[model samples]
Target: MKYNLFISLFVISICSVLAEVYFEEKFKDDSWEKNWVYSKHPGKEFGKFVRTAGKFFNNEEEDKGIQTSEDARFYAISRKFKPFSNEGKDLVIQFTVKHEQDIDCGGGYVKVFDCSLKEEDLHGETPYLLMFGPDICGPGRKIVHAIINYNGKNNLIKKEIACKDGVYSHAYTFVIKPDNTYEILIDGEKVEGGDIEADWDLLPPKTIKDPDAKKPEDWDDRATIPDPDDKKPEDWDQPEHIPDPEATKPDDWDDEMDGEWEPPQIDNPDYKGEWSPKQIDNPNYKGEWVHPEIPNPEYKADPALYKKPEICAIGFDLWQVKSGTIFDNILITDDLEYAKEQLKNLKDKQEGEKKAKQALDDAAKEKKSDEKDDDSEEDEDAEEDDVKPVEEPEHDEL
Candidate 1:
């Protein structure tokens, strides 16, 4: 047992060492300018990406990230690198997004592209290999998308992953394996996962309901039937409601002034609803008719459906309504442990940032309260000034 454990550990170590990191960007310095490219296409009005401190933890000088500078504008920024494939290896894409402006409707997703991408022409129409991140629009759409491109079409995950809805930093991670399975993680905890073939429509369904098959006319699907011996009671012929015995007409009420007065209605105590026979087991019932299924003719199996042929570049291609979404700590690697380690290091910093943001928010609320009090006081003083103590009219006094 000890020898077998040692062998397994050795194999895992080797796999970890052999894992490749295609590219990574932390946006720590001016290096991001040269490493990244932004869209310059006209008529779209793309927003500028700026490197600055996050909106919440402005005091934390060390924390910096790229944020959109304008609101209600398109954003398309990408970085190019050597093209690599995740055909037989695990592909992990992890990134962080902080919407400090309390975004009402916008996208905070990133896309991985093929080598033929034109950075300047990147827009909504641009094709991509994968897109993963939070996309919120009002209350109806609060989803973290895990979309993958297959054969020229993109398939969205069948399962809905709820996104963290607030002004805090959230880490989104997507992992695709060679076995045609994928997992989605938020803040290093797996949220949703399933087989790629089952969760996405990358290919036609293997089996379909046979269209020609139908239930026979004599098939019985009822679970229960009326008891043949059950009969309505002879005394169950009472009306549902009757006139109240206690209600009386007033003596002063004129017959001509008011229409004929009637006693108020009261529920009949002995009345029961329409009587029916009791139900019993259906004698001839076999089962519910299930439509037969057969192999779909359009289904052509593709073993490489889960494999992303080339993931050469990745960048933010989104729009923001309230602007102030800081994106940072991006890491793309096949090593899941390395991604976890990076996330672990961020926990401490993110906690401190959260506390700092709360403090600022509390201070702003206090200031706003004070301002409201001062305004109320000013309004009282203005009212006093407007009242010239009702000047006594000399003529009226005489």
Candidate 2:
């Protein structure tokens, strides 16, 4: 059942064609860290990308001679971006990566969406489509993601990319044409890229998970919630090797020393959705999720659902031209009064806009009238002069 649901999502996200956030490069360069995060991911040390807030990424790595050897890679996530929902000749989204380590240090890529850099808070809660970045993650252990502020609610649409081979930062970009084609550009070269579109259905967010499974009302973290049914061990903390941070207690606290672990309780009873699978769901447990033909789990899926990527931006829209419709271009009127009211409101709204236009036209007419009045005055004066003709010069020289 679980497997089926997993496949269901994968098929919908992968097989079905939907909307996309097309992108293109604005600048190309080989030296990273100048603009990109050369050593650390955008965090408190690097201030923030969204909201213009947060501490910045760690400067210690660069302050010292510490570079990502292999385990500690860094990224300078973009603070500005244009989603696929904008107008542009073509998205020239470009990025560059450099390797300083003898062993390739993970990977580098851009994430186009809205989300906190925090990774743990992304469980069952409705996120404003925090687009997880698509790099560093490789085959079997990779991430692809997209996000949106759909219906004023944040929706996350993810596609996991498998981990790749030896690590080296490589410049990668995805071009989005106005006609709706996602051409993958690698190192300024056109490589292979596919189409993955989405709207509302394929990413139908699971609203309910564990409704009743909630942090207990009288829950005290220091003391274990007594199990009247006694299905737990008495000395669960006696195990020297446990990750439970709260197990440090007085020796007399659990006099039994029976080495028993208490059964954990659910905080949200309505929660049924996977906290995201420990592994990809395929073979069996079937409801809706499915596997993608080409998975990119950490890819930046959606950013529009966050804040408008930019105001008045005609950047990239959807991959397919059909993805867009003239929402306001054509108006359908049913009720006469209602239609009239709408028209009036539009006119009133346009009233502010038309005022400047009307002023310009009025000024033009005033100038023309002023010219005509001057000509009329000049004509009248000329007529008076003609009536009283001046005497001609006499031939006195003769």
Candidate 3:
């Protein structure tokens, strides 16, 4: 048992030594401004961000994060980190988003840019290597976008990944492995994951329909055909509508006064729909004509599709009609374990925040209940005071 424990400790230490954290920001203090750059791109109304714990939180100081402070504006902000290449390692980008404002139409995702990006000029037009996070618009669209840029074209994931909603903070984690696979997590739970190439149109299909090929001239794809021997019934020709048998013409009815004295029309029970010969299986009918596929000469496999050779900056370039999204606990790393640990910490904070919020809600509810009771008592007292003792029946007789 002792030997096994020693071995386990050694392995843990080795794993810790291998993990590398490229960038991490908790927004613990006001000095974040020194590290982050706000875009000054012209003509766009950019919103400012405020650091606060919001209305309720676990801890006032520790929970403070940058929150969007404007409505119907663009938010462009980014920060630089040491350049890193994930050529043979896993890349994980994790962050916490608090939609305390109950955002209606806005983006809460982060974009990853290469070192070539000018932080001050970051905007919607700027290219990015990856974009991953929740985006909500109206009630229909509440999706987590996992977009990848390849060969200068942005390709969105083919699968739909639903995101968390409501006014609580949730952690979003995107993991890209060296094997070209990905996993998207919400609050430390895997929501969607699959091969990168299969989910994105980063490359031409391996096989494509042979444009030069055509169906044989005699090929009959129809599975059924009208039978030549079957004939329509004689009664099948009845009109759809006929004069009602039960409806009689009024005695006062006059053809000269009224345009017509016909009875109301009723559906004919004997009427059959449009007549046609019975259908039978066609003897010569062939199955569906499947287009043969051939190897696409344009397609070239990329083993490094998941690699970002010069990832050094991350940005938030979004348009929010309604703001108040708090972003915090941003972390980019090559270590999966480290990212998982960070997520665990976020989950803890979320639990604490929920307790705090519940307490506040309970207190407010109690106060309102007390106020209502006091009002009722006051109303009862006023009613008693307003009631004058019925004047004793004029007591002159007494």
> By TM-score, who's the top model here?
3
Better candidate number, 2 or 3, judged by TM-score: 3
Shift in Å, residue 85, candidate 3: 1.7
- Residues 75-184, candidate 1: write the lDDT tens digits: 99999898888888889999988887888999999999999899999989899999999999998999999999888998899888899888877788999988888889
lDDT of 3 by residue, 148-244 (tens): 9998999999999899998889999999999999998888888889899999999999999999999999999989999989988877798999999
TM-score of each candidate?
0.84, 0.28, 0.90
Which residue pairs in model 1 clash with each other? none
lDDT, residue 242, candidate 1: 98
Q: Candidate 2's residue-wise lDDT over 132-158, tens digit each?
A: 223332235443223334445644344
Q: What's the lDDT for candidate 1?
A: 0.87
Highest lDDT, which number? Answer: 3
Candidate 2: regions farther than 4 A off = 1-85, 99-107, 112-133, 137-139, 142-164, 167-169, 179-181, 188-398
* Prediction 1 TM-score vs. true: 0.84
With candidate 3 superimposed using the best TM-score fit, by how many Å does residue 67's alpha carbon deviate from the native? Answer: 1.3
lDDT: which is higher, 1 or 2? 1
RMSD of 1: 5.0
State the lDDT at 1 in candidate 3: 100
Those runs of model 1 whose alpha carbons end farther than 4 Å from true positions after fitting are: 1-17, 40-43, 58-62, 365-398
